[model samples]
Target: MKKSLIALAVLAASGASFAQSSVQIDGIMDAGFQSIDYKGNKVNGIGNNGSATSQINFRGTEDLGGGLKANFRVETDWNTVSNKGNTGSASTPVVAGNETVAAASTFGNGEIRAGLAGGFGAIDAGVVNYNTLGTYLTGQPFGTAIGSGFRTFYVNDAQSTSQVRSDNSVKYTSPSFNGFNASLYYAAKQTKAVDTANTVTNSVTTAYGVKQTSFGGLGAYDMQGTTEVGVNYANGPLAASFSSLKQDFKDVGTGTTDQTVNTLGANYAFGDAKLFGLYQTNKTNTSSVNNKAFSISGTYTMGAVVLMAQAGELKNDVNSTKSKLVALGADYNLSKRTAVYFRAESIDDKAGTVQAALTPATIKGADTKFARTAIGIRHAF
Candidate 1:
């Protein structure tokens, strides 16, 4: 009788454990129509991610006694127009211009991670989204949407710089203390490809004599280790953030170099209006390639509508030229989970033929200037 009771007790405990675990499904659906005019040439099409990146997310968590918990997330992104899964490679920089070169479909390409959480905060390992200067993190009025102007001035992953999502990475987030918290991340080293003669080598050399190999559109495929650190503080109506990333690189033979980027941003709310400001600096060590960017944005909320405007500039010290961006837009909330928006943005760049945000195939010449107007709808669940 005692043995039978012991078996029953074990089964009861197992059922209780299972009851403590939970799983859910959630995601965003956003799509829009865009009319782009470049150097007097116009084109119209449907675009994805106008207001927010559309994605499907599956999340699960389990209580592990005490104050600990285990969790995992699987997310996948897709282009609404093509109905193809996004591989999250659109952020990788190229020598020509921002191009759509990812595979037609990929699974779990967005922020897949598994980790634990407790009083110490959380630690996760996987392909992690580590972009600290992105629109959401910086409190950009348009949230990196069509006319945010954030992308024109600052790029999270630009050839020798940082990446939006660091693969093969481990990240640790600290528990909040007095409205302040921090994150530390590290990505393992990767094998780099050496340049061979006669090969279509699309490389860039900083003034300091460092060269980066971009085997024709495969810039992020091979690289060294990467490190990123960031901190954020939120209290009442004021919020601030700062982040720094260092990426190491290697060249043919035994030469190595590194790139670093630093960003600082803050936002403040005043009644029905809010203001945001951001400053960033990037440098390729020893190359004397110093780039600086800054932007200021503001938004006013009235009833169910929010209006946004932003202006920014990118000073490319390497080429002794500057690129400018101006954006205006508004979002109208249809409900708590749905929104309709419109954006009009323009960018002017004469320094480099390749603008990271514009499609190279669509752009005409080295000196590029363009304007885009878009209307979109978003739904979240």
Candidate 2:
């Protein structure tokens, strides 16, 4: 009887170990309340409102013989507040007037993977978080929660398309060596054609020989490509990284060309305090203008209270316009995964042609002066 009991116990233990070695699910959910002051008018309300902006990810590994392993990850963004009218909705509408789907899968070697993840070295390709490069270098506070601070100087003239998260991409990453790693990625544009004649409102009506039938053809350009490269070195209290990106679009026969972007950033840490800075420039052969931007930020922690501050400047060479921004924030950490934060920001437009714009906020109307203050709580799980 004693031997039988021991054997049962051992089998149970073995089963538990095998179960632990199988796949696991883990992710984070971030949400907060934000306010904006566009040209002195204050608009305050619950934002991202009850939506978690959450992600569910699964990870597993199959150990092969001879120290080899097959690893995989499948991730997808979820709209936790889909039932709520104001929550889980996109901050902005897409070109197709529909919500975007965030789903990605990666299968490859251990830490060194060659699959769909985010962008290449610094960018994100498939369904991942922000591109590694932007997240590492620019460190823009509003890139995640909000869609601001993701553009060059002149391109942000209060009227430009915001940065977009990539989709349908393949990426490769090298194993980290001494806290250093590199990555690369490519995204495929699955285009389609549309016939406006059947979709038009007035189909069978014609008076002045105006052709109501129109056809638009869309197809992926094989010659077009997006490239990203980045390198980083980190040791103890000091870390730095640099990255660059270039996007080439197939000629649409309208004399419009593709775009290119360059960015550099550095950060130094001392005890509980750190200083970060970044400079980015954007150019295009289609236009005779160039945009440049620079920003510096400082963050310090004191027990449960953390203080943060940042200043930025943007300039346009063709228009000789410039804009300046300043921000200060504080956070009280309730625990490792939860915190309460307060932030205040101000923007001053020095450009005679451009208006003052706020970071992380929109300039919907046409007013110039903008300032905002907000206090919110964020929890990551």
Candidate 3:
């Protein structure tokens, strides 16, 4: 849920006149108690976002006339109890469940971008998700839907800084036509590849009067740029999306392999239920390392109540191992802006899914299966 407060005013740019220049503040706070059981151990505690992730954000727009507009957005989530920025990731040292409320890492900016939009389409540059995977995801069971999201899923495993989002990126979105649209994104690899440029080195004088040079590019990775393209169709009760993404690196393990991924997915709606499915494949050109995943999910909405379920499988062809996930949950809305939900999910691990490396220390072990249940409240403002 969100609220927008608008203040109208006239504005002129590029010798053109327009009206309605304003800004708005919006955010959501979701928290609740969650429980988890890994193998034979069960742990419970009060955390946050049992139903959704908590976040705060601000966005505004200035009409630039001639069907053009200027816009900016900055969003960051909070740790709530600490009243500080929230850290979306859990570092190995910060996984103690019994740690004090203020022990968690500080919050961080989620996305910040500024861009222009017009009859042709829209363009934005900043920390952004440059991939069009969302178009195909539709009602993805992952994300904030309690037990519906499977962490081992491939769609959530792409971690190349620019996979789903990047620190610096430019994205272009085409205007919709007949329920058809397209998007393209490019994220520059921030690295000084060897003798890259003047912006990568510094000079200092040694005590012996000898000129010393210090290069700040060592260990810098992700040298090549990243590119993503996506197309989607949402007509009537059917919606589908397709995307191809390529991540470039200076040297891909032994001077071989190019990391590339492709995904296709669709969603169909009928009555009070919607069906969603996605398939993805990722490969390294010069290596036998590859990953593939398939997922199916569904949601049912009855007035202010909602139910969700999901199942997925991820396979690592290189190791001939796989992981399976299943989840189910339900949500009840107290009002248009607030809700409560209960969710439970489990991951049946066969071979370790690399994505599970970040699992909290409290839940890390030689467990063949992981499970959890949670109840939470979410309110948007």
lDDT of 3 by residue, 1-381 (tens): 455655444433322333357678888887788786665567788767666657788888887678999998877657654444345444222111111112133333566789999998999987666444474356465463455443455543234222345545788989999999999988765333332222222564223111111212223332345688888888999988888887665342223335677777788999999898878887777646587878899999999989988888888888898878788888899998888888888887775552443256566656667777888887888
Backbone clashes in model 3: 3
Comparing 1 and 3 by lDDT, which wins?
1
Compose the digit string of candidate 1's lDDT tens values, residues 154-257: 66643422336665678999999999999998876544444323333368433311222332323443445678898988899999888887766554223366
* Local distance difference test scores for all models: 0.69, 0.49, 0.64
Error of 3 at 362 (Å): 6.0
lDDT by residue (tens digit), candidate 2, 1-381: 001112333346665444433455655554456677666567776544121235555665544444444445665555333335323333221222101221111121112222222222222233332234443344443333322233323231111332333334555566568888765655443323231222223565423111112111223222234556656667777676665655554432112355666666667888988887767777766655467778888888899988877788888677887877777777788988677777776666554223232233453445555555656666665
Q: State each model's C-alpha RMSD to the native.
A: 7.8, 8.9, 7.8
- TM-scores for every candidate against the unseen true structure: 0.81, 0.68, 0.79
The TM-score ranking, best first, is 1, 3, 2
Question: Which pairs clash in model 2?
Answer: 118-124, 118-125, 119-123, 119-124, 119-125, 120-184, 120-185, 121-183, 121-184, 122-133
Q: By TM-score, how accurate is candidate 3?
A: 0.79
Better of 2 and 3 by lDDT: 3
Output the better candidate (1/2) by TM-score. Answer: 1
